[model samples]
Target: MAQARRELAERLREGGSESAALEARVLMEAVAGERDPDPFGRLDPDATARLEAFAARRLSGEPVFRIIGEREFWGLPFALSKATLEPRPDSETLVEAALDCIGDRRQEPFSVLDLGTGTGCLLISVLSECRAATGLGVDLSPDACETAQHNAVVNSVSERVSFVQGSWTTALDRRFDLILSNPPYIPTAEIATLDVSVRDHDPMLALDGGADGLAPYRIFARTLPDVLAPQGIVVLEIGAGQEQDVIALMTQGGFAWRGSRRDLGGHPRALIFGYALK
Candidate 1:
């Protein structure tokens, strides 16, 4: 095991991986099907083959989570698919802000609607905390819906959640106490300029936000109010420098800006909103 780790780290280092050693350790454990595997143990032929393949994929710019087919968000495991975006730590800001907004209502039987749900991380995480809350996750990709459903089951929240393939809130007929979304916010042209890890690996449908990157926000502005309960709150993840634009769009839709939350990096990442009259 020590030999394999050293060799993989060396290869990844040569391939320009900044965190080669950590990647090596993670990949090794993944191949062994355990966390922190025995350092003295040797890999079987199958494990060795799998490690080599995984190494090559990593060298080709696939993210570690993509290779492993899962990622941890809000301390819960969520499976990923070709059609879904890998839930990032920045997105946790949305969950935190949403929960903060829900505050005293956390114990209530609130309903949550997560649009562009992807891996269902936001909805599932929220439901995990609000035991009495039920959620519906909506994604445009069938594969994403299936993957999210599986994640809900893995996290033991399947009974409280349902996944559907649809565009935004089109499939919904009822209002929700909370609505969350981390829609694609990258401008169409800027996508090509993103780092290879993101540009090459994440699904484009989960990244592109049309010409100005505010297309999804526009859709939300036009449709969100209809699905928000009288006292409902909406928390959305926005790209850098997008707070004002998104707030304006939501305001045009009759949503009043509540406030915003910053991610660990201190970027304005989560925007909160509620109906203007309420």
Candidate 2:
């Protein structure tokens, strides 16, 4: 165990990362009896081989989340796959803004629609917050839909959330009291410049925003009017520089900007728009 830790530490140092040693330790413990018991008292050779494979993948530019098939968001563990984008902390602003807009608990349950749902993080977080809320998460990828379903189950909200495979609101036939999305808002041209963790490992559909990084918003603006119940709210996660453009599209679609929420880093990250009549 000591020898393996030392080797992993040296590998991490060469990779310019400090967390490698801790990860290796945890993996080693997991393989051994400390974290979880194995068939053998000591670490299983097969498990150690798997750990080496994961470490090699991580070293070769794969994200740790992808290698582990899970990510932590809102303090909950969410299962992830190549089909969906990894959950990011910045998107938490969507949950906060949604909670603020939805207000105190209601006697009647309200429905939420999540477009481009990836790993069901946003929808599941909102359902976790609003006890009276049921949500439907939509994604174009079938794999993403499965991943979202797995997340809903893991978060203990499967009964309150449904995952559907389709683009935007195409598969949604019911109206929702609130809609939220962390759609692809990065301009297509800028995708190549993203960090290797995102550019190489994350799903392209979750990152590419077409031309101006506003295509999804445009589609949402055009489609939301049909599915949003009267007086409903739409909360969207926007690119660092896309607040105004998203607001403009929402305005053109007859939705009015309620407010914008900044992320922990103070970048304008979430935009809340409500029906103009509201």
Candidate 3:
């Protein structure tokens, strides 16, 4: 099994996978159906065959997360569906920023709204931490909404979370204490330049952000303020180098700019702002 893992990693490395070793381990674990067991002892003929097939898919440029159909965000395992975007480490920046902004209100029944919610990762993860919170996740794609609902169930957050398929801020007419989103931000022209894992595997509707990658932000700036409660906080995942432009756009749309958080790569990834204090 170890030899198989190494062979798979080598093939991935040759294919330019940055985390070949890590992906190999994750894939093997899935095939092994065990956590950190003796890989050599864990292998059966059937498992070995599955590993080879998984390795072949990986070599062909399918992301390990997609092949495994799962991802980890904020220490929780989230299952991925074809309609949902994989929960990425960078998106965790938004979660951390939201948690920090809501530090003292963790036990309160603070309401949350997640826009363009794919996999419902943002809202569901937050609800997992904020035990008393209730959340609503919104997305235009029906399939994504269903997947997110399923994720909520698997995470045991269904009791506190609900999902709906509708345009941003249109399906509901209520105020929320917090709003979060990791909306599509890649520029239309730049979508073609993304890696195969994103350009081809990820849905174009989830990747394209109009001509300048600011279209969704523009929409947020226009619509979000109407549904935010007094002192309500807003956390958004921004594309790299989009800090000032996004801040300016939100400011024009009437949100008070608070600040932003940087990701591990030192990029301004999560922007934070809020309504005027009550």
Kindly report which residue stretches of model 3 are placed more than 4 angstroms away from their true locations once superposed: 276-278
Which candidate do you rate higher for TM-score, 2 or 3? 3
Best by lDDT: 1
Give me the displacement of residue 243 in model 3, in angstroms: 0.9
TM-score of each: 0.98, 0.90, 0.96
Which model, 2 or 3, shows the larger lDDT? Answer: 3
| Cα lDDT for residue 278, candidate 3 | 45
The whole-model C-alpha lDDT of candidate 1 against the native structure comes to: 0.94
Provide the overall lDDT of each model, using Cα atoms, as 2-decimal numbers.
0.94, 0.84, 0.89
Ranking by lDDT: 1, 3, 2
RMSD of each: 1.0, 2.8, 1.5
Compared with the true structure, model 3 gives a TM-score of: 0.96
Model 2: per-residue Cα lDDT over 154-244, one tens digit each: 8899998888888898857789998989999889999989989899889999999998999999998899999999878899999978888
Query: Residue-wise lDDT of candidate 1 within 1-278, one digit each (tens)?
Result: 99999999999999999999999998998999999999999999999999999999999999988999989999999998899999999999999999899888888898999999999999999999999999999999999999999999999999999998899988678999999999999999999999898999899999999999999999999999789999899999999899999999999999999999999999999999999984
